[model samples]
Target: MISIVLIGTGNVARHLFDTFRLYDKINIVQVVGRNEQALAYFGQYSKTGSNFSNTEPADIYIIAVSDDAIAPVSQLIANVKGVVAHTSGSVPMEALSKHPHKGVIYPLQTFSKERKIDLKNVPLCLESDQKKDLEVLNRLAHLISDHVYGISSKQRKSLHLAAVFVNNFTNHLYQIGKELCEENNLPFEILNPLILETAQKLETLSPCEAQTGPAKRGDLSTLKKQVGQLKNDRLIKIYELFSRSIQMKFSRD
Candidate 1:
């Protein structure tokens, strides 16, 4: 059995703890954090504490803390014999170099405590300083996920940048759409089907192939009307920037 001591009690930590508990081969030795209130959630199922100085020896110590706190937290457990891994995509593996065995187990998905995500489809990016430690991380990743990739720190950094464009930036666009709908007294729900279809097209078609709209077709008249209708300068600039980018990408001649 693979025993894991999960550090931190944030969204990622909670989700991982819930998923690990369902697997019989995995044992959650402890969930440690500085916040007593946050530890209560994990305390219901396993041993929980705020102190990191005293911790039981486990097969792996997973740090699910913020990117800035990763290095300092790893320092606390540097003496442990178990493999030390952080769940961060952008942070380098050398952050945990203080430990003999260091690795990364980054899950490429947005985590929310209220929203439960299925690990089966989420990609798990694994990396390690040692070859044997990589195998250990791979074994652990396969327990809850099927899509596991041996990704390096450099590769993971690029993947994270792309994710920001795809997930974070796209979500911001959705928010802008919602605001536009509200300004015109239209229900945002009216765009739900269109949004769903846009995402569905990506399953069978490449993003470039699935592209549509006035910008793609170079409909300057419609684009001008969109810009003229926007009351906010910020929204107008955003629309103009995106439209220019689309035109540049899909210019015919």
Candidate 2:
């Protein structure tokens, strides 16, 4: 059995714990956190501890805390042996320099407490210092998902930035859609189908090939109307930027 311990109990931690629990070979030794209430919430299924000393260590320790907390949390577990990995995108493995063996197990997707993650579809981006450690990560990842990538610290950093653009920025656009719907007295449900269709299309078609909208067709009238109606300067800027980019893509030789 591969013994493992998880740190933190936030959205990412909860999602991972639920997924890891499904596999009998994977053992969650303990979930550690400073907050009494948060640790208590996750303590129901497994052992919980408020500090590293009280928590029973395992073959692998996963620090699933925020990017900012990675360094500090890692510092607390510096003396522990075995492979210590963090589930962060931008943070470097050197952040856990205190540990001889360190790596990343970053899942490239947005996490929310309300949203149930389908682990099989989520790509587990894993890396490590030792060859044997990588094997462990690969085996662990395969247990939860089919799409596992042997990504490095540097590649993960770039992918994280790209995720910010695609997932984070796209969600902001959805928020903009909600604000627009409220302003125009329109029901937001109408956009739901469009959103689903756009995402579904991406599974089969390249984004460039699947592109549609007034910008792609060079519809001057609609573009002008939308630009004129955008009360938010930032939204207008984004619209203009994407419009110009789309026009360039189609009109270019």
Winning model by TM-score: 1
lDDT of 1 by residue, 1-253 (tens): 9999999999999999989989999999999999998888886755689779888899999999999999999998878999999999899999998998999999999998779999988999999979999989999999899999999999999999999998999899999989989989999999999988988999999999998899999999999998998989999999999999999998853
CA lDDT of 97 in candidate 2? 80
RMSD of each: 1.2, 1.5
- lDDT at position 145, candidate 1: 98
Candidate 1 lDDT (Cα, whole model)? 0.93
lDDT of 2 by residue, 101-192 (tens): 88889988899888999999999999898898888878888989989999989999999999999999999999999999999999999899
The lowest-lDDT stretch of 10 consecutive residues in candidate 1 is: 42-51
User: Cα miss at 13, model 1 (Å)?
Assistant: 0.2
Q: For each candidate, give its TM-score against the true structure.
A: 0.97, 0.94
